[model samples]
Target: MAGSAEGFKEFATSCSGRLFRTAWLLTGDWHLAEDLVQETLGKVYRAWTKRSRPDDPVAYARTTLVRTFITHRRRRGSAERPSDALPDLPAGETDVALRVTLIDTLARLDAKDRAVLVLRYWEDRSVDETAAELGLSAGAVRSRSFRALDRLRAVLGTDGLTPTTQNEVS
Candidate 1:
């Protein structure tokens, strides 16, 4: 088995990008995203050094990310207020409009709802996996998923998901 320190360094270097993206989606703030990833990686490294290392480090790290996000949201004075100003995206990014709209809609949801959407659709995890990660029952995961999708559709409106030109419609 690889030394825990070496293994963690390798894992963090290789997986940081994807983990950052997930954290960004969960936190809805670039700064918070970076902080979340750092905190999660620290937790993952500590767990990796333990006697019983997780069989799947990536999955464990992902779970840690979600759990950390949830815990952070639950702490006093941690609730974030929505800002009127939008952050600038990088140049030459594809589908900027759509991305902004989706992020805006996601920002409207509470932390747990946002987490459910990201984990289920973005991470492509099963109901059971999401349930376990969020510390909810499978039934609760399904109910939350349904409610989250409905909220998204309601908020997105016709202009958000629909094509402007009829010819583009499938």
Candidate 2:
């Protein structure tokens, strides 16, 4: 029992930051992200003791976070209304401006679509891995990815980075 608890702690300590980042990106709010991370870790800790092999703990944690976010969004209504306008970027700054634009654009996306973008681009997960993590089929993942990218391009303007029709995000 003690050994299992210790093992769980070790895993949590190592993966918590990455998990939190994923949660933050999913929720678009720091406080909500923290709560989601806590909930995910609690569930992971509970499962850690009973699992046989516990391979790919990161993947397990990520799947838990995604499911938790999806459930919460469903219960609270699908659309999230931002109370304030997006923050403005300083003039003549390209990187920061682009990042701010991207964040604002991402905030506008549907929860599941945003999850697909984060998993595919930020986490650099392959289609198969993303599909498995979200319990989606490969074709579904591809379609969702395409749609998300298209939405992003529309939001960011066609002048910004546009996803290729060949299924590659630019």
Candidate 3:
């Protein structure tokens, strides 16, 4: 038990930042990203305590975070309306305008489209891996990736984010 806790602590300490980054992309808000990471780690910790931790904990965590994000999106009530105007950001955020623009554009995307884009482009995940994570066939992942990028291009006015290739993200 002691060893298990220590191992879990070590894994969490090392992976939390990466997890947070993925969560941040999945959710376009810092606070929400933090909450998502917390929830993901909670799930990982439960698995760890069971001594049934995955052989690849990193992959497991990533899958868990993605699944949790989509699940929450599905379950969340539509009572909360998104505001067009972004809140005033705190100091010291690099590339504020760029980040805000990208996040804002991403926020406009459908949940599944956003997930596909984040996994395929942001995470640099392969088609098969993304397919497994999102529970789609490889062909489906490819189709969705293409459509999602097109949707993103449409939303960004076709001039803002035109990647050279389907896999490339600008």
Clashes of each: 0, 0, 0
Per-residue lDDT tens digits for candidate 1, residues 58-164, read 99999999999999899997886779999897555356566676778889998988888788876779989999999989998889888987787787664555434
Q: After superposition, how far is residue 158 of candidate 1 from its true place, in Å?
A: 72
Give each model a TM-score: 0.46, 0.44, 0.45
Cα deviation in Å at residue 103, candidate 1? 50
lDDT of 2 at 51: 45
Residue-level lDDT of model 3, residues 1-170, one tens digit each, is 22288889999999999999999998888887898899999998888887455878899999999998888788757237578999888554344465567678888888877888888888889999988998889998888888877876776676656444332332
Write model 2 residue lDDT over 32-128, tens digit each, in one string.
8999999999888777878463578889999999999998888856476666677777444345576777878889998888888889886889999
What clash pairs does model 1 have? none
Pairs with steric clashes in candidate 2: none
- The superposed Cα distance between candidate 2 and the true structure at residue 157, in angstroms, equals 69
List the candidate 1 regions with Cα displacement exceeding 4 Å.
80-170
Candidate 2 positional error at 136, Å? 55
Predictions: Cα RMSD each: 19.9, 19.7, 20.0
